[model samples]
Target: MRDSAPLTPPVLPDRPRRAARPLLAAGLGRRDAYLLTLPLAALSLLPSWLGGPPDAFLRVALPALLAVLAGAFVALLLGRWPLERVLMGLLTGLWLGLLGRVAFVLLAPGSAPIDALALCGTWIPVLLAAHVWMLGRAAGRVASQLALGAFVLVLLVCGALHPAFALNTVGNVVMQILLASLVALGGQRSGLLRLRREVREQRLGADLTGLGDSLTGLPDGRAARRWLRQASPRRLEGLAVAVITIDQFHHVEATHGEAFAGCLMAHVARALEGALGDDDTLSRLGPSELAALLRVPDDRAARAACERLRLRVASRPLDGVNVTVSMGIAVYGGEGDGLTLLAGAQDALDDVRDAGGNRARLGEARRTVVEDMTPELRSA
Candidate 1:
């Protein structure tokens, strides 16, 4: 019953975590932020049409058509459909709006007139809000302040010309700007937080393959650093760090091509993985270097582990090409830190490579020799 209780808890958390992911992903996406515009546009058009002239179709159709075209232009801007081209689309749409309004006034000559100024004023706020939303952070901040200034100017002019509708216009402009700001800032913040939380949770969970190399399935250098930082204290009690590097790896890359080199690395990685024990961690520290942290009782055991790995790799044939690995081993009992320990192992590996590859050197008290360094080191 006690054994079963531990197993049951692990299994229970998996189902709930899996179910919650899709729910969070579907909430508050980029397109949902622009949905309110459709309804707002419809409401803006409807009131003017209801109290319009007998030739209401001619008066309303042009404004409605321009509004639709303007809205489509805003969508293209948001979609980032080529800046050079979308700017042209915006100019064409603006010209069409003006031409349509002029055509409506000329054709629908009537005593019960359409207030074209009121229609333009209402549509301007909606378009301004959309433009502000599409602008980048630095530009958007400036644009928002400019929009507020424009609204204030409109309010002062409209108050003198149309006192009865000025208050309504002021309210509509404020509402549209406020809505756009909330959608742009609040929606972006919430979505970013949700995405970050998801990634962090995944990092903490069982599936940690993301922390490793895609091709080799070995923990990457970042992961290696993190593990070393965490395990350095325990390593001081007695642990081994070994850095294994393939000799003349760039020559292999240049001769065989990148794809073949990648395959060879993957093959080598598998052979190294097979040599590691349950307590050992294998990591890809560089393009041609693999680092392993081994759990050992004493210095001999650490040396044995390094030799075992080196022999295992040398014996393996990758795609009919014979391969060999050189290793440098360092014990952590008398080290400054984990990084220092890794550097010591790298120094030892360099010594072996200089003496000719396919060998393992354990606990040599020397820093990395500059003359013994490869072309990559000399260039750096």
Candidate 2:
């Protein structure tokens, strides 16, 4: 019995956490797919050589247009599908290079090898643009811009280095430089628009996901008091407000740690939801505290209603964990004013603390009292 237990590692509890799939699954509809149209738009620069015969025109027109569309599609696909994207780059470059060779030879004889290189050069920039557009706002913007710039410099250097093809080389270099700059600028502008859209979506999601805490979502004491006046207790007879908090919740937190406290609060919130009506409005009133606005029309009925609510809560355990709730109830006495109800209700709720844990007390709503920003409340 005294054989000292082999020093054992402590067991750590796993907290229930949300899955990342939600964030990833948060996607754009057809409205968001408009970015993909960029590459297709680039196809507008088909072989429009009015000087050439119909046969010559068709020969240039078909290949060039196909090259543009295919280049963009492959690039866009590659960005989304990494392995496929690499494959697309290689295959696209090969086809474009071959096409460029043909286009160059037809337009300018073999004497201009530099012109041949320039046609081939268009492939890289087009693909880069498509990849950047496909990458959305994240990694692609920088990548696509850098690729365009690098490709331009390569063309310029190739031109400057090969003096034999000076006329062809210089003309191609200047034109390509401008084109690259435009592509780079276009990609960046699209990136900026995409970034803004992403930010807006993230902000809207945060609002929907119940991500905000009580402090931000709940109005301050003064704000709550003022809002209650709109409740119009006279028009509707009995609107009861209950303010409840877990006394010594901090003490439990000190002993069990914040994780346990959070678990407890979550459990309690669930318990509260189960005990109340579907229409009841609830908010975090203070640290480890909650407030409920119960709409019941009369005095005795309101008191009975409050009692039933209290009993439902007191009887149910917090997720099978040993914990208790202290409930404080205040009824709106046809006084629709905010401060009167809030202060009176909060004060009455406080009185139950002296009577020991697991008790509910009722009173008249106070007039024009400020609200407390508790950590527990979140948006509905």
Compute each candidate's TM-score over C-alphas: 0.42, 0.39
Error of 2 at 372 (Å): 33
Q: Over the stretch 193-271, how does candidate 2's per-residue lDDT look in tens digits?
A: 6775565345322222232244334333333344465546463355677777776798988988888787776666666
Q: Deviation in angstroms for 108 in model 1?
A: 57
Q: Candidate 1: misplaced stretches above 4 Å?
A: 1-210, 366-380
What does each candidate score in C-alpha RMSD?
A: 15.0, 15.1
lDDT of 2 at 92: 48
RMSD from true fold, candidate 1: 15.0
Strongest candidate by TM-score: 1
Query: After aligning candidate 1 to the native by TM-score, how far in Å is the CA of 273 from where it should be?
Result: 0.5
88-120 per-residue lDDT for model 1 (tens digits): 354345434633443343233452223554454
- Model 2 residue 295 CA deviation (Å) reads 0.5
Error of 1 at 160 (Å): 59
Stretch of 10 with least lDDT, candidate 2: 371-380
